[model samples]
Target: MSNDGHPMKGHRFVAWLIAAGIIAASPALADTPTGAARELATKTCAVLAARVDEIPGSGPVFLRSYDSSFGQGPTAEPALANAAFTYDNALAAIALTACGHRAHAQRIGEALLSAVNLDRAGTKGRLRNTYRAGAQTQRPIPPMGWWDVVASRWFEDPYQVGTATGNVAWAALALLTLSEVTGKTRFRDGAAVLAEWTVQHTRDGQGPDGFTGGVHGYDDAPQVLTWKSTEHNTDLVAVFDWLDRAGAPGDWSHQAKAARAFLDAVWDEASGHFFVGTTPDGVTVNRAVSSLDVQLWPLLLHGALERWQRSLTYAEGAHAVDGGFDFNDDRDGLWVEGTAQAALAFRAVGRATDADRLLAEVAKELSPSGYIWATRQPSISTGLAIGPSSATDDFRYYRRPHLGATAWAAMAALSWNPFTGQRLQPVRVRTTGSK
Candidate 1:
């Protein structure tokens, strides 16, 4: 649990220096390369800091995933109110580490630990997709809910309370990052618990030979999801690899290999892109749609340049929108988070100019409230459903100030890779005849 290097020194010191005006401001705010990144990172930190738990020594806290002003009006998505998504919180934790706020980041990590140890269903190794935002109460942890005056009962969104493999992986990644930076065994142990649950519950030898979507619906009768996602598996590749290196008690190296196998299977060498994932059967490849994240995330892998370098070019040609990128290949409008992912991918590939251009576009997404918008349009579709009960592709992103988007922008600006807890390194080239 000893720190190998001071993660708190470099970026953290620089950010503090910037705040104190010790360094001259970069030219043309949000225009120059470093200026755009600095602007994004500074604004993101300001917004996130405002949401920190005010009380000293308070239990872990979850930052509300969106601004309160979002879920209003007749067309309101009320379920979002006070819902702290695990994915966003995880991203925020990693972003906080990059921004030099390890204490604040650890609070969020403590919240994830709460989720792990005190799940509402009393499950030992499970976490919901979302939890009630703010300071933690006693165990079993509370699920997100609000009073429904019309129904005269407390209502909770099924999707919010459910566990998704991708979200869980993200939480583990966040914990692993905190553990790495803080050298805290508890955070690493918590991540291992989540990874154990994933390997036990979701791993599949079905068509794709990877992990499944995870459980959905209510606790009493949770539906086991069978669909396998390239994105989710991509996440697992990193998680399992980290666990393997940590020498956790499991076949994590094998788990990582299986996840990589899935990634390799779904890779379309002819098309130069990855398929979305498998269908509900878990065996049949679901090539009906293409997603932006699936294309960009894999490029963060160590040997990505050797195997999937073309994916970067393929993503740009297909998903680029107004200098940003979209959630899906339809390219309906800009998805801020995905655009940030693309920026990091560009950075990973040593295309600094490409990264700078994408970042400049991302800088424009800064909302007046200091958070970034989820999307450029009023709404944008992802061609996916909210849950198993949904009949249509109702999943969409609104033009709301989003914690996830802001966190991603901060990571991109700081050149940090959420998966690795290190700055994004150029994709490694394998010498000929190398393993």
Candidate 2:
């Protein structure tokens, strides 16, 4: 999103100026963790909520991603036109709500709900992937697989669209959280619709495994990518757990049971860690790639403390960087999104000191203009090129200010738990209304 204000040159510059003023006005408070988090959240939230592109009647919608040097779309073509992802907007909604920007949160939530309805026109209430200018972009990018370096090619196809289980689950979480915040049944109902669609379309039953975790979702031709994902299943488990706790209408326990079974099937008892995903034929992918998400999610969402500790230990040895965590075991440079996520996960598992250290490192990556880099480097080609030439491409890469990284950073700063929809500091609470 362009940060240009009517009188101001750009939003980034103005945001930095405001942040400087806040720091200068209260140096002591700014030095403290609470103050630092509040400052970072305020600055990042402002940039995230900036209206770079304004639709005729809808007013200004949040830009999906931005970068001062590279511009938008460094990662995907649609981002260049400021195409908003349903998942990214959901993240913004949750972060905004947690940071006490209720009005901003409501605006994002409503827009997303409208987008969902528009996309669900013929699907009988299934949520689609993305919305740009109030219309669904049926041809959206699939989920990013940073671990498999050649995976970028999968997203290069413009005709490809996916209803990723993780995306759907996250959208449901955001809607459910928004419902709690606003006392709006519409948001809850929207969440239920997504949950139902996930149950009907994503869950696989033919395999020996009870639930095939979940499919990679569907493409434009109504084709399903039959790979079952441990990460996506973990996400569903959290989603169902949240729904169960919220008293929302759904067979959450049943969903969670199947999801847990999928997770158990993928778990490597010897290593005490979960594999990435399994193909329809049951061949495992990404077994060698040490995924930060795989390491962090079980602990953060499922409360698997022993496994969490083991995974953390493995990650530190395999993917640790100077100030942040790598995207995977092979990658040398830090993945900004993964780092921010690791920080929150650390706090969730009672590693406050470790979380603080990681957050400090992540803060260093923030630009003077108040944006977070998607990664420390432009490309992760170095690590990806290590294997045989036939295995992967040696493509160059670039970095940009990613909305997902910025959102996670804000959530980490505020000690907000995305999985449980609770704050980590002082003590965890069931509802958003509590401090």
Candidate 3:
């Protein structure tokens, strides 16, 4: 975890130093997060931070939320709980693999594969909270209302639906990340399913202007509303980011076209921040309140920030105190859900200072027991203590994959590593007649 001789540091330094060189025609790569913040950003916080009590027969989970005293005894205790909702697990999967923990990544990958099945309707998996099958509700097409959180991951919706945000895109991203680590075609095949689902189901929720928000079109009806928001923008774009990264065959360039079209349509030509879902009242919204979606877009697409340049309103206020993000607005200071997303965003646009500023705050709040403080309130056991600090608190994202997905959190941090593609150590292969 300390400064060591490695390629990641170099990569980190390069990304962090980007702004000093641009203000002209779109360069090949402009805003890249670099330096220690860049390096540490991608490193995984050991799972020792937070601890949780699991049910005897229940599946393991990463607890995102927990009690301060956490147990019957008034002692300052810790326990693993649940996985985070977003592609948070993906962050850990990528970083762990990057740091040479391919085996651990594979284990997490298996858990992910077992968690949900997107196969044909007759043979699908069940939703985490509800009993309805994942295949039934998430197939042939995606149900749009699934992203609404409280909608219940599973319910006999008789109507069927999917959450477009992480639901539609993460399957592909996770599969791709797995493929990169293990080079397995099955993972790629799964990723393909993700691609097909989004390609066809795209218009399911999108309105006339292209960008969309809300449940899938009710029985493929006419475009009833034109809503715009970060969730709509990022999920759709990520589907393209995957296709782009997956190197899928055929002339599917239209995905990018679709991506850009949607981006331009909803890009607020004025202020930067993506709004809350577009309202039925045609309200104007552009605030710094955007969620993980805003951060993921640019991080996934190198030239994505340029989409903002077309109007001079893309994260303009960025680099501000909160790096233009409002993590502080929530009262718990930096966090796993919100700030982690912001960390990804900051790294994407080469905001090393901002990335560090945010991480530094979070790191300071981390407990030595390996738990990133679950929250900055109540017991002061925020449970997210894995950054640049040496604090102790046994409430880490590990041990709880169901509700607390630390894998992706770890991955996002490691992605900021200065040395992503290269191995820190040497590897040798046997030749036709060697050894």
Candidate 4:
């Protein structure tokens, strides 16, 4: 028997070991859609369609950024101006697709490709606040000598800032979605790189985890800027999940192992919670104690193990706290928007009753722009009003209403998730020859 004819048994043993590892690892969850879910999606899709840009090479979105005077003005809607970051575009892309606005999402993908062409803007793009005094903002993707700037970041560039994990992961997801839509290998390859980097860096800072912080294992060692991230750990897990499921080969096994390890370390089995950021001593509950009804990160990342968030933090004056669920941080209670997002997450894991109640609140007060933002509620904290690294604008962060979070909340409300709570399908409201 020739030795070269037979494959090594040791190699087969390694393959089995890897397979066992993946099987033992946690799996990312999926959601199905229904009536109200479809309606919310349908309305949101209509809004995106009305507002999207129909350009040639760059499928740029046409809208405006929020102005303080008008927290979300006509000009504040997404426009060509805010299309640079991969993360924003990624979430927007997936939400649009979920809402059935596939073309609009594709345009987002195209615009991302075109952004690579802008030679002047570097990692910061063409933002007014960035690049002081005539500095060229756009640099070639993977600027010649710099080490961490990968071809994907240079090419896709999810968020305007390099360190934003949400941008990196979400944008990568959007690209993966695009690859699914367009049947292209390029999108898949680029998305894989970004996803790998996200998982690697989130735990140990292997691939420039984007945020310029000394963020260590569950530690808030804010390195670059003091602007903290409550969602990076929870949200970036989404990247690991999508890439893992997508069969992204290179370094995926390692990335998955690292992410699993990091998540395991942060989960507090004792308190039945997950620490958003570690206190200096590691056991103190300085960061956050529990999950919010509105916060979907816990649900999305961990699939809501009954033991972790089976408990609820309820609002005052409620009747025995019937709708209690996931906790809200920053002292922000269960407002309509937060409730709606909570409903969305619940729907993801077969909690339809909760989803209906949450979506109902949004529908009752849904604004003309297809969203809900209450200005008078003193009990609740506005979600999106806090600017991205706009710590300098602390007054605005505290005083103004949550604008960005409102948009996201609205998006979640309108999404169609059959797996949410118990799959409350959208009521089919058709307008056929009705005046």
Which one wins on lDDT? 1
Q: Worst ten-residue run, lDDT, model 3?
A: 21-30
C-alpha lDDT of residue 406 in model 4: 39
Q: Write the per-residue lDDT of candidate 1 for residues 85-194, one digit (tens) a residue.
A: 99999999998877777777889999898788767676777999988788886687787778888989988788888899999999999999998998887888999999
Residue 4 lDDT (model 3) = 20
With a 3 Å backbone cut-off (N, CA, C), the pairs that clash in candidate 1 are: none
For model 4, residues 1-435, the per-residue Cα lDDT tens digits are 012212253234324434644212211112424555444443434444434532333334423222223223233222212323344345556655555556766766554443333323332221111111111123332211112344433222212223445555555666677776567766666667665544444444333221222221111222222322335544545555556666677755455455444444555565544544433332333343333531344554424444434322222222012332212344433354445556666555566677676665444433433323332132433233123344441311221223233334435655433112112343222222110
Candidate numbers sorted by lDDT from highest down: 1, 2, 4, 3
lDDT scores for all predictions?
Answer: 0.80, 0.61, 0.38, 0.41
lDDT tens digits by residue: candidate 2, 53-162 = 22323332444545445422254444334445667777877877666666666777766565455453255345445545332223321222223255544332221134
What is the lDDT for 31 in model 3?
Answer: 30
Best by TM-score: 1
Ranking by TM-score: 1, 2, 4, 3
What is the TM-score of candidate 2? 0.77
| Candidate 1 ranges with C-alpha deviation above 4 Å | 1-33, 53-57, 70-76, 429-435
Cα deviation of 171 in candidate 3 (Å)?
2.7
Alpha-carbon lDDT of model 4? 0.41
Query: Which runs of model 3 end up more than 4 angstroms from their true locations?
Result: 1-45, 48-86, 114-164, 202-228, 249-252, 280-296, 307-324, 327-337, 367-369, 374-409, 417-435
Q: Judged by TM-score relative to the true structure, which candidate is superior, 3 or 4?
A: 4
RMSD of each: 6.9, 7.7, 14.2, 18.2
